[model samples]
Target: MERARKPTALATTPGLPPQPQVTLTDSNARLTATLPTGESIDILLHGATILSWKDAAGRENFWLSDAAKLDGSGAARGGIPIVFPVFGTSDGHGAEKLPQHGFARNSRWEFLGKSTSEAAKEGVKLDFGLSSQNLSDDVRAQWPYTFGLLYSVTLDRGSLNTTLVVTNDGDVPFEFQTLLHNYFRVDDIEKVTVKGFEDAPYVDKADQFKTKTQAGAVTFAGETDSVYTPAQGPGHPLVIEEDGKPRFRIVRDNLEDAVVFNPWVDKARSMGDFEPKDGWKKMLCVEPGSVSKWQTLEKGDAFEAAQTIYLV
Candidate 1:
């Protein structure tokens, strides 16, 4: 059997800057990275949350709610929000309660600097690290497991490569779930078709978490929130397209499942953070994650997951 390689850095793309070309947005502290190819991406340092990603043509294709805050008071209403420690409101362990998606999406991470390798032939990658070392008492009180997390966001001409490396730095073992809550933009939600779920069983959140096997490609007609496990194989990448042209192509590694969601009319009205009740018509969140099973990491152990997104 072939040995699998452990992830230690960002996956290389064709062109990389000698160093990350970084700048801060004048309007907000969001950091922008411009690749040598002129493709660019924006990351808010507060949560290491991706705010915007532009394709080669400089056309932005990611979703951001008009009411989303760049100040980081809460998770930004859109783009790619990181989920860590716990996947949702309650971890079901009867422990102390946590916010909807844990604290990673709302906590500030340290900028560990950027690097590149001529031997590796990779693009400039930004490294952001988070440690419980400086977490406030309030944040630590909820789920106190010491950890070190390194998040790398790499910009490519047609794709964005994001990887999360989580290490258990505590004395005891810990269990957790994580997800990458990505909201992709579309001209019309109903018009887009998703491929790669066929024959896979899913937990339909709207149907009371009932498990059903996908008969074919998925399309949006009403509010949709479904979780599909072991979501890939020979079909490989998940493609979201309209009129047979690819919009977003998603590839995942070490991530075991996918969450497909759109809040639609009623849920959108109930969400105070979602701007404009009609915003649901233009976006969809096809998140890849490890929510199918909780990960138990022993002391000094590490876990990694990555998602590569291509926009055409």
Candidate 2:
């Protein structure tokens, strides 16, 4: 038998230590999981940005944009990212437009490690932290409230749960608006309808911003925008029906307002990247946002709001 050639160091050690089992970086927030079909979900919280969300089928069609980059750029409410600290334009109760959705969403955040229970059986939870001690020019120029924001994102059993924990770090109290601007993917907007808030109170985006009744099950007839107040509680699931069959369910807790929007005509056409006509027909936004008035969070106190998205 020919003597085997002396094994070279390179040949003996194949492929860099198996590439280190797990990848821990700012983009992934150090969470862990292996999907049933052998895929993964990565959560990036720097500036509260969702860096990447790849499904089991190796599909990552979800929107991923830098929240920080959109500051003062007027692209605030167009994606799946969540922003807090006086959502929308506050009419006069400390609603500062310059900071639109506060600095937490756009400011860099520090990883807080595996949530005391970050990883769950059905999903993995990752936590990030931000406090006044970490504020910079951009944050200070805004609300000027000394606070801490803890963001928890969990991916499990065919859905994602995002929770926001706001803590008061200052000596005084403050009031603000919040929102989890959910950007759900769908086959087509025309082929779907949002069912949940029917007959519930809603303020139309048009007609001088007055409250009105839905009159019937929600459907995309045209450019639709409305602010809902005194929203129905638990069990009143916000169902997104695709072709009359439930496709996805959005459930929110402790959120008093639910804003629904689909920019079909004017607003969609104004954006260069958005194919006005096709865009609206492709996506419908159901904002589980807190607005129309300010909610209070006192010193040394904390408040939380969360929402879960599930496949149907």
Candidate 3:
């Protein structure tokens, strides 16, 4: 994994508010009722917590990280973070140009608008934006690309739907990898299994591009890493079953790849930020991403990907 260069500080937008100043701050992570539907969804970038995300019948649909057990101060690092152009790797080995996951997620994005109206369902929709104009010197020095990453999250109609549009606004074009990095809540990693794209080609990172498949209904017995390729078209639905029953189905459209990572033991012990045993069984990182040939965005051009998680 190449490290990105350390970023230098850039001047802030002349009239932007200081970081994390919400007009309605109950806490950094709190659920607010929206207009039409009146459904609430928990947001935890302040602390990886999701206090709400249930159905009308009150069924726990999404998986919550064990760290989600909030302390007196509420914050969890394991919830949802929009990973930009790159993930897990920088431009070099131990650079500060970009942090481990890039600047977009670490920077506090502005919540422009929100709604829970008829245009959507019982959940909420939030529109957030990040652009080169607002980036710090640190981010600019690392990649030197001017761009905007817009995220739209809607918990409506019994599904968690998100859309990310990466727009290149610099004088020159740029290329990079990305993922939604969704940490879906589940009952037990042991009790859960994923079904879809069995026999589909996958890249074995250890073998450096070797491809293989395990047929159908892949079960997570240990650490697993497979980059599912060419995941376009009317793709098969991915179902995560718990206790021999279907808990939820992840439905995607026009997606190119699925990065399935279940770092059961190794990831836990290695990362101090995560409680290995607590996280090992409660959630799965099923990312909808673009890699292989990095998704390129031309100046003023945009690329988009979206999906819905229907609670069953």
Which has the greatest TM-score? Answer: 1
Candidate with more favorable, higher lDDT: 1 or 3: 1
The TM-score of predicted model 3 comes to 0.78
CA lDDT of each candidate? 0.83, 0.66, 0.64
lDDT of 3 by residue, 215-244 (tens): 777677777777786333325677778888
| Candidate 3 minimal-lDDT segment of 10 residues | 16-25
Query: Where is the poorest 10-residue window by lDDT in model 1?
Result: 115-124
Give the winner by TM-score: 1 or 2: 1
C-alpha RMSD values across all candidates: 10.7, 6.8, 15.5
Counted clashes in each candidate structure:
1, 2, 24
lDDT of 1 by residue, 19-115 (tens): 4478767454578887666677888877889888886578887889888877867889888989987777664752346787788888887777777
lDDT-based ranking, best first?
A: 1, 2, 3
The parts of candidate 1 lying over 4 Å away from their true place are 1-20, 25-28, 94-96, 117-122
All candidates: TM-score: 0.89, 0.79, 0.78
